[model samples]
Target: MNVSLILIILLIGALATYMVGDKFASKIALLFGLVSLGASILLLNHYNLGENIGLFTQWIAKPNISFALQADGLALAMLLLTTALTPIIIFSSFGTEVKNAKTFYALILFMAFAMAGTFLAADGLLYYIFWELALLPIYFIALVWGNGDAEERKKAVVKFFIYTLAGSLFMLIGFVYLYQKAGSLLIEDLYQLNLNGTEQIWLFAAFFLAYAIKIPIIPFHTWQASVYQKAPTVGTMLLSGIMLKMGLYSVIRWQLPIVPFAAKAHVTIMLVLGIAGVVYGSIVALKQKDLKKLLAYSSLAHVGLIAAGAYTLTTDGMSGAVLQMIAHGFVVVGLFFAAEIIFRRYDTRTIADMGGIRSQAPKFTSLFLILVLASVALPGTFNFVGEFTVLYSLSQVNMGFAIVGGTTIILGAYYMLKMFQSVMLGETNAKPFADVTANEGIVLVVIISVLFFFGLYPKPIVELIAPSIEEIVNQINRIK
Candidate 1:
């Protein structure tokens, strides 16, 4: 009857995809994506302050947990991002020869259901359940359908699985500790419970480690590049576009308010690590020859800055982090999609193997150029807006960190342009390449439009998120 119900219907439609023949699996996924998008739009239209919708509730006496679902501005934003990208990822996979197409499509839809539950779940335990639930399908999707050396792909998936699971166990420990203290697993209840400085510190540590691994912050990022490189483009898109944000979102939603004292105490350490990640990731990306590996490192650099911004505890920092999450999600998806197009055309992802493609593929070259500029945080692009705000917020904490972190702009531009020149500028090194196909063009155009539209007019997104961020910040300050 309402948007939430429609979303549930879409999830059912996705599961029903299993019954459809393999030939129509991709179409079914696309249809589910469309319906999910419509549901998101309807939800947005009906959105209001303090609005909470519950789909289910049940008592769990042992830990005082309850099964529940709720919606707010943050949840809505994440839902919108997830639904909007599913169709594009499905569309982009159209030409690929997926052997178990029906099962593949079913997994994608199930992943959507899990992701939606992650955003909507009101109970911490339920949220964690959805969080872990979201990973299995992706792991299989990557391992089974992934490209590159088969052995390497298997290793990558296993490593990714093990690393993420290890980190999540720590987070679960934090939740159990919280349940012991608060006698409830509901997020609202957790928010209301009082916590001591020492307990908060340990809890925050557990939560931060888990989220850092998911975000793939510098030192914990060994598994990401290989995973990104091996996974199919659709898998990579979903991982970067929607999954990475889970960590950043959890930082804002869980760690900050729940462990305010510890956050305040360790803010400097967080800033130091964040700045280090920013510089380190950018520098490493500069040396990457494979496009997927390059983008994977680039994502690390961007998330580093976002993590720093979130830890700043300033309104600008938190709000900018959220916007940056949305901005980077779109930009990175576009960039990866561009890489996919290039690989499809050249049958290679190595930068050295691509050259002078601009002459024969002007349209592809032009679009690639736009995406590159966006990646480097050009003034007119969404990345610029997010990065600028994040840096400004960092400046308020320590000008030195801000300056060091800000160097990412110069480094980003250098590597992105270097990549562009290597791949798109020189003489045709391979068989004459054709322009982007209609499906590819549609995906690129939509992404570009989103980048430009948001870059020019970010006020709506800012307005939607500001109040919730303010409330969270207030809660953090109150706890302090």
Candidate 2:
């Protein structure tokens, strides 16, 4: 099957949209995104039946690097997530007053291409290329089309770019070493390399450094809140909803698989750090008065739990991490869109200023409540399936880890309820709080429906990803 065709479609659409100009760029981008999603679904169905979707060519013969792209279970799942979200992101942007709409919409498609390329690249150098490619479009999007004071936005975007790029340098170094040791940049070759403990240790640190910054775990998270606050809703959505997953996905795909010894040896400490982000992020969220920043911290906590799950090195944990990524991706997009909807009407993000929105706009309130519930992993929601599985995995490892990690549940509920009560449940405001518009309603409906569908019947995703999770688990277990 044609794995890279989606990338071609998205990239070509980006260029064409630029040519068509702003008046129609949004519609064209959305159309391309929908087509890409349809193709990915077909590939996913083909993939589930145990067929390969691979593209290979010699790119650098001397160093044994290839322009290889493969969509195994893990890659397909991530690719599907990227394609599925792109249309919604574009559709969600339908009402925004983004200057140079053609450029803005085109960049979104380019970013999607880079993300898909990152997911499908089966060669180390190629993967790194795609990974780095993703950072540029989002940077410009946030910088050029962002909200707030010009000086402040520039500072935040600059910090974000510098921090993430610095991390990428380390990942590149890690890849270089692996290439030298294995004599090939192919993922398969690196996976099969028999490195000693010392080499694995350094390589693990190198790769993890990049992922950590992108994941923005604990201290590295400095760039996150400000960037989210400063960015336009579209920028915030792309960063939180999809870009962050790149780091988590790389952890599962590259770090643990190629350097299992280091992963296992350091698993406990790494897992501890991850759990710390969960507790830390939630506690911070509880203190935020700004709705967007509050949601940012909430995102941090959810992803921390997901990261902890990945580091558990168990089938359940890995599977849960994958599922949670998809769940969280959709939920966060809806949440941010809600935030934007609120700001559009009221022109303020301060929690203190938001009240009686529910009384004014019942439908919007209901959808938001559902997203809030899903965010906290309420029972009968898709989040619960993944969160429960992850906690079970940690508890199997040590009840203590589960105990610590589970704080997000309590902390999450506390802050989300607080946000809802403050923003939606008060006396009706004198200011207007209109219901969700048709465009906005469509996006939210799709998000909620998918969450519920997967919540009730998650077996298809679990089954599709089971083999990849099993393969990853076996790799980690084989470490010695």
Per-candidate local distance difference test: 0.87, 0.92
Candidate 2 residues 74-166, lDDT tens each? 888888889999999999988777779999999999999999999999999999999999999999999999989999999999999999999
TM-score of each: 0.97, 0.99
Clashes of 1: 2
Query: Per-residue lDDT of 1-480 in model 1, one digit per residue for the tens?
Result: 243574575578677788897988889889988888888877777775334445556758775678777767777787888888888888888867888999898888888788887887778998999999999999999999999889989999999999999999999999998888878888888889788878988898899889999987768888888899999998999899889888998999888988888999999999988888889889999999898999989988999999999999989999889889989999899999999888888899998998998999889889989999988888888888999999999999999989998978989889889988888887678577889999889999999999999999988888778777898899889864
lDDT of candidate 1 at residue 333, scale 0 to 100: 93
**How does model 1 score by TM-score?**
0.97
User: Looking at candidate 1, what is the lDDT of residue 368?
Assistant: 88
Candidate number of the best TM-score: 2
**Top lDDT: which candidate number?**
2
Candidate 2 local lDDT, residue 261 = 92
Alpha-carbon runs more than 4 Å astray in model 2: none
